[model samples]
Structure formats: structure tokens, C-alpha cells
Target chain A: MTVQQNVAQATPTINLPTINLQGNHACALGAVAAGCRFYAGYPITPSSEVAERLAKELPKVGGVFLQMEDEIASIAATLGASMGGVKAMTATSGPGFSLKQENLGYGMKAEIPCVVVNVMRGGPSTGMPTRPAQGDLMQARWGTHGDHPVVALTPGSVEEIYQQTARAFALSEKLRIPVIVLFDESLGHLEETITLPDVTEYENTIRKWATGKPEDYKPYKADADGVPPMARPGDGYRVHTTGLIVAEGGFPTQKADVVAPVMKRLLDKIEINNDLVESFEDIDCQDAEVVVVALGIVGRSAKKAVRELRQQGIKAGLFRPITLWPFPTKSFRALTKKAKYFVVAEMNAGQLILEIGAAKVDKQSVSGLNRYDGEPISPSLIKQAVKEVLGHE
Target chain B: MTTSNKKNLEMRFSGAGGQGLQLCAKIFSKALIGEGYHVSMSQSYEPTSRGGLSRADIVASGDTPDYPLTTELDVLLILDQAAVNASEGIIRDDATVIIDPRRTKNPPQGNFKVIALPLSETAIKLGSERITNVVATGVIAALSHDIPLDIVEGALKSISPKKFLALNMDALHAGVELARGLKTA
Candidate 1:
């Protein structure tokens, strides 16, 4: 969710945590909003509603919805159709999302633009059918093996869920990369009153094409912004995409010279597009002695807890990363100068903590308030951890 | 700034799932927000979908209310016994507790005042089980005196569909009437 501090509006907006549309149907509408023409998600807990809704809604706009053989085919088919010059996506929970990792990496490697919605469930293996967790935040970044780039956004409201889904696809297509829209089980099943905006940006976004003369076009030719124009198979641009390292124009080559820059470009696109790829919300952290870092649904709990601590005259703040990858280093690094204590509160034992450790270790006191029993990490525990880290307890 | 009596009012509504209690909570919060006050709402429920502990707590003040206040509430609306018994100990001295007498036999403990009204039973008599939340909302409107009946009625149609909308509207009227009768008594 975008938190715009509108000083000029001057209406004294209430402190109510703004309401958003729920997660599952939000995914369906997001896909539609992002101009996705193909969806193939298998039924899974906390995420099945998305598939169920898309099955009913996809046809009205002439999009395709299929129940593929498995999660692998689910992504592969979506990727293939997306390469055919249509925006595509797949939705799944933990197990299925885990299953799609192999193809997900392939899609990243091939620079195939698409969106994947992981309606996260509590899991090492199907831990809970209807619960919320942030364990997968790290996994969403590193689940696929090898050097990969990821764009992830967590929605704390039903409205953000709907809008983020669309935004994820737009980023995927515009940057020619895959994006993971993270919504856990609790969010997927949540029912709320969401005001659907009549005007939205999803209607206008990048549409990959089979452009230029079929005979003269080099399929991988970099455009001014560095993304090469992609052409479909039957477009006669004579292009090929593979999981293996391929040379320029997508041909199998042994020379390092041919394969190196494709990898560089794939990684570079995420950097060039970092501003658009990232999203977050900040609380009163200025002059805060203790700053708590969190993501996904647990982030909401952090916001609540911070408010309570501040009331007691405790200088506690919440630093949340909406875009997990291309980590919010600038903000965190700057924060360490002012903040003395840092706490990482996520659902897993200590997954996202490693990143905080990487960002800054000796700079401040770092700790984790982790929960893995299929329950949400409450704010009181985080506040207690903050107090202890601050030497108040 | 003139602090209306609503500035100090905080409320908790508890009921079973499928009873539309959460929707009612949101509508009441929206109505209060329309009055230009601070409002925050949160709901807790299990996965059962039919019979479960579903509750929505709304905190409103001239300024922001402290984090999901748990110590003592200014007002408590309980649709069942579990709510009153669960929260009976925490309400502040002189705070008001409203319960659906049909659901709970035990009176509230502590220094808090208690009002046992069969709002749900009255709502059932008015025609449907769905209107129970709307009636409970009216009981709240009476106790807090923060939200207007017109605002709550408008919120009903805005949230529910056309088919069930009229029933909830009448349910709101019946709720306001019952509160008025209690006020005179």
C-alpha cells in the first residue's frame, strides 16, 4: 500500500488503518487490471479463490484459464503464452509455489515477463490451510536456485492486494522479468469492503510485441531503455529461449563473450527499474532509538505495536520492506546512523534476518521475533523485544 | 476543538460468524469517520465460517486511540455470553456494558454498568437473523450517541446487496426505536 503523507490536503485524516480489497479475487482482478490474457492456476488453499474467480471472469474479456497438469506446466504454459505476446500469470500457495521454482528461475533466466501470485500458507509442508506467515519472504527472493532477480510486494489491505497484483504484472512486462505478489493465507480468505476504483492504471501497460519487419528484426536487439524487443515464435523473428546459457539472439554458444551480457542485462533491468519495482510504508522512525523491521501481513501488527510504544513515550518505529529484493539498503543504511537497535520480526525462525544482518551487522543491535506455529507474530512480543534491545526491560 | 461525547467513546462488538457482525462494525466505523473523528477497526475469528468467535473492536477518539486498547473499554456490545464473560473483568469503572439478554444469563462483573437487551431476539422478530448485527449496531449508536441513524442506514445499503438491503434498513430503524424506548424509561 502507498502511504502518501499529504500535508497540503489538510483535512486531518483519521488514523484508521485504511481498508483494502481482499487478496484472492484481488489477484484475479489484478491480473485483469494488468492486462493478463492467460491464467492457469491449480486449486490450492488460501489461493483457490483466485483460480475460481478467474475461471468465471477470464472468459468475459477473452482471456484463457486452464488447470494444467501440475505447477511446473502451470508456469511453463503461462510463460509460453506470455512469450506469444500476451501478459500471463499463475497463482498458488506454498507447495505449488515451491513446485514452480524451477520454471520460475527459467523464466527469470529467459527474461520472460510474467507475474506469479503466491497466496502464502503456513508451511514447512502444508503447516496450515488457513493461516498467515512471512516465512516465504526470503524464499520468494531465493527459492529458485542460481543467480536470480525478484520483485515482491506484500499487501496489508484488500485494496492494496488488488492494486499490487496489477502493478506486479506491469513491472513484470515493462522490465521483462517475473514478479512475485506475496499474500498469505489469512489475507486470501479475508472478506472486507473494498471500494473498487473506476479508473486504474492496469488498462494501460507494456504489451510485448512481434514488431518491425519480420526479415530484418533481431529478436534480442536492446532498445534505448535496454530491454530487447521480444517476438513470439511464429512471428518469424527466428528467436529461441532456453533454460541453458544462450548467446546473443538466443543461439546456443560456447563463447563466454556471447552469454555474459545476457545475464548482465537480466540483472541490470531490475536495477534500472528499481524505483518502479520497490514499494513500502514508514512509521515515525525519526529520532527513534529502536526500529523494528518486518514484512508481509506481520507488518500491520508492527504498525499497531509501534503506536502503543510511542504512547508510553518509547521511541520505537517500524521499517518495512515492501519490495524484498534490491533490498531497501539506502533507507536501512541511513537508519543505522540514527537508530541504536534493530529488530527483525517475521514468521519464520530467522529467514529475513540474514538480509538485515547483511545490510548492517556491527552498526546496531539486531534480533528476531520469529513465530512458526501457524500463528501471526503479534505486536506486543515485538514491542517487548524492542524494549529489551533498548535495555528498557 | 469542541470534543463531542463521541471523542471519548470506544466500543467492542462480539458475535458468531455468518451473523454479519464484522460488516456492521465497519459500517459503524465509517459512519463515525463521516462525523470527522478518529476510528480504527479490527476483527478476530477462527476458520469455522459458521459458528466461531467473531469480534470487531472499534476505537474512536478526538485524537488517535492507543494501540487496540485491551485494559478497559468505554462501551462493550456482546451478542453472546462468551463475550461478556471474556471481557467482564476489564471494563473501566462507570463504563457501560450492553448484552443480548437472550444469549447471556449472567450479569457483567466489576464496576462496569450492564444493560441486557435482547436486540437479536427483537431483530429475529423483525424477520431475519442477518439483521442481528444491524440491531446491535443501533444499540451501540444509542449508547455512544456518536453516529446518526441516517448514516447507519445508508451504510447498510452501501455494504449489503439489493435483495437483503431493505431488511437491514428496517432492522436499523427497529434498533433505533428500541434504544429510544430504553432512553425514555
Candidate 2:
């Protein structure tokens, strides 16, 4: 907080081309760039900067920013705003992320498009507010109850945080599902200099609004893509949304036939379009015999380890999934074709590694290098893991 | 682990909380990035509002930094004895150590290059001890060509408040002069 502000220059649009910024600030600015017009959240450590920055910047762009009483109301307000035809978002850390789960399921069930940025910290319950952890990886995918699909993106750097936030918005809007931008405490607080590309560099997607006659519109009706065209309230079209099973006419239905397709479409919207939602980074992986699978800040360290192993004449590589959910199983399977050994490095106790093993990538060859401590996984530890997995000289 | 062939400079600025160590690291990092280098900074602080240990580790390189954390420190600037103790086993043999001799009565015996500067006293002489971090940052800019003094001045000008701009600039110049006067031998 003692860091002085930049000189009194006119506050340009939050999307400045070049700046030194924290990862949390980058998410807020990226939200603005992606045409996000509403933000609602209860402040929490590591993730609070996004809410704090958006509270100030959103108003300047003719948007709405609200500080809700709790994480529950925060996500509820975000869902409400998104239903009202605006790109909306809410951010919170571990405990708050847990509190928002029920509403997150509500957003998913109702097919509301919004973003939830979870800056992760150590937690079973208020464990370590200031330290970094990937404890929420599995929680993010399965936190909310029931069977529903969601997209979650993990960023390793401030610049990637910015771009991934914009992508989260685009994906959420396109898929009509709440997208989670996962951030570890280390990444959320990291400060770095980066050059943001021009707005033309990334495409932005907005939800399709019903263009049919008001009387002919069905709020829950699906188009060819299996996503319903949304019509905001007061738009002369029926706009009923509920957590209960809903019919295509936007009315609650008890019939099994009506409820089954509705639930099916909710999952199909993301699962069927998995190719569009999945994103992963392959570093020195083409000819690698040893592959280290990592995510978020741990992935950055894995990249360094891979570079070091390569210098030692060991064919090591890094597989980092930018999108955590949907698990990017196809990419891991692709790597298994060439890899002789797999070293899974994560800040959690074998969360994503289990998923890699679930992909059937030779369980005998996959080694779990787990860390649940509050500290980050160092590149040296990862290199040591690689050496152990490969039994190299 | 085998090290890479990349030549990158890694530095840490440590002090008790409220010493403005994070701000000093940020100013130096921004200046290096302005000179067209890739820079990443990571800082760890006490969970409380203030008064515990605070440190900011920075990695700056011509190429993008693959590992953003300070795996090995090339230079360390400590403001107090606690910082000196905190850095006991981490300081590399060839690294440079710049310390304020008033707070740290005895510098550690090591193969690293050590330069003693009374940064707090110098800042107090200029106007206030709050600018000691700025004074230390000035010494860092002068010690290496990686961060030019002009760029640091420019960075400080933009980030420092108008109320302390003059004093902070003076503190920075004083730091540069202090470092310039020192001889390695």
C-alpha cells in the first residue's frame, strides 16, 4: 500500500498497451477490455485487488460495481447482472470461493454467462490467507453439487492472467456457463512489466440475443450450437431462470422428458464444444522422453526445470494446461505417445496428477511430485523429481 | 540441476515491514523494463499490516524470465540485521551485499562483495528516514549498468508522490553518489 500511484495522468481505458501491473489488476483491466460492465464481490486476500480496481475503473466506463455482504450474494448479484444482458464477473479467494459454490451451481444450472476469478490460497478452512496453493484445483471443477460442466483457466504470469481473463469472458459468453479464472496467491500478487497486444489481437464473444418476435421466443430453447439465445428481463420476451428443472418455455417443469434435455444441453454445451474450450501449452515437448505436467505458477517452475534438464542432454518437456477443467485429457494422451516418463508437479497433493493418470497415460510411468505446503514448488525440486522419475545420470 | 546458459540478474531487497522495500524493488524493476528488459518481481510479507519481515525478490533478463522467483540472488540490499540473518545461507559467493551499517553492527563474513552505506542516516540528513529505501535503490542503480541512473530517476519521478518528489530525488542522487564513492578492494 505504500507504493505511490502513477503520476496524475488522465485515466485512460484500463487496457493500456504497456505497464507494470500485478496479476489481480491485470484481470480487472482485462475484464474491462472484454466489455465486462458489471462486477460484484466481497473482498478477500490476493483476489481483493481485482475487486478494488474494478470498483474504481468500472464506474468510469459506465458500468456497475457492487461490494456484496458475502460471497453468496456476490455471485448471486453477478448472475443477476449477467442475466440482464451484460458481461459480469465476481472474484474471491479460497473461503469465499467455497461460499459462492451454491450460487455457482445456480449460474451453471440456469445457463447464466459470467466469470468467477478465484485467486487461490491454502485452505481447508481459512488455512493460510497470504500463502500460495493449488488446493482449489479439484474444488473448482467439482465444488458445486450435481453434474454440470464448467471451464476454468489457470494463468502463470500477469500477462497471461490478462489474456486468460478476456478468454474466460469470451468462453463464458460463448458457452453460456460460468468460467473460472484460477489464480494462485503467488501469481495474483506477482508484479511484472508486460506489453499488452492491441485489442484487435483477441476476439471477444457476446451472448446471442433472441432476434425472433417477442411472442415466438423461448428463453430456454436451443440453437444449433445447443446454447439457448438469451433475452434479458424487460426485453418483451419471457426470461424465467431457476435452479429447478426448467422447460424450454422458461417455466419450471416436472416432466422427465423436459428436464432431461435441459440438463443434457447444459453439459453438452461445454462437453460437445470441448475442442473450443480446451487450451494447453507445450514447452520443449515435441521430442521429449520425459514430460512434466503442471498448472498455474507450478507450471512456470516446470518450464524452468525442463530447460535445465534439456541442457543436461535429458529429453524433458513441460505440459501446462491453461484450461484446468475438461482436464485437457487429449493433450496428455498425445504426449503419452512420445513420453517414456511423466512427472506430475503440482502445489496440491496429487490433484491434477490423478486426472493425468485417469487419462490412462501409463500409470506405471506417471510419478506424482506433490506439495501441499504454503510455499511454492521450486524449479529445483521439480528438476529433482524429473531426475528421480527418469533415474538419469 | 544443471543451470541454463541464460544471463539474468536476480536481486533481493530486504528490510522490516514499513521500510518501503517493495516500493524500492518496484521502482528499480520498472526502470529495467523501460530499458527493454523482461522483469518479474515477487514479494513476501508478514500477514499483519506492518512491522514484520518484508522482502521483494526480482528477476530481470534480456530474455523472458522462465522462473519468476529468486532461485539464486545475485545482489542483496539489507536494511537491518534481521534481513542479514534472514539471508544467512542464501547469499551466493559472487553476489554483492549492500547494507546499512547502523542497523547491522556486523556484516556477515563471506566471499561475496560487501559495501556498507548508512542509508537511513543519509535519508535522515536529507529530510526523513522514510526515504532510506529510495536511497538504497539509488545505490543499486549505480552499482550495475543494468539499471541506468536516469531510468531510475524517471521511474521514481512517475511513481513518487508530488509531496516527496523533491526529497526522494535528492535521496536517490545521494545514494548514487554514496555508491560511486565506494571502492571494491
Q: What is the lDDT of residue A16 in candidate 2?
A: 57
Per residue, candidate 2 scores C-alpha lDDT tens digits across A293-345 of: 89889988998888888888888888888888878787667755778778889
> What residue runs in model 2 are displaced by over 4 Å at the alpha carbon?
A1-16, A198-203, A254-257, B1-7, B84-90, B105-110, B125-127
Model 1, residue pairs in steric clash: A20-A158, A20-A159, A21-A158, A21-A159, A22-A158
What residue pairs clash in candidate 2, if any at all?
Answer: none
Query: Lowest-scoring 10 consecutive residues by lDDT in candidate 2 chain A?
Result: A1-10
For A237-354, candidate 1 gives per-residue lDDT tens digits of: 7777888877556666667777678777766877776666666666776577888888766776787788788889998887777677768776667655678878889888897788
lDDT of 1: 0.73
lDDT winner among the candidates?
2
The weakest ten consecutive residues by lDDT in model 1 chain B span: B63-72
Per DockQ, the best of the predicted structures is 2
* DockQ-based class of model 1: incorrect
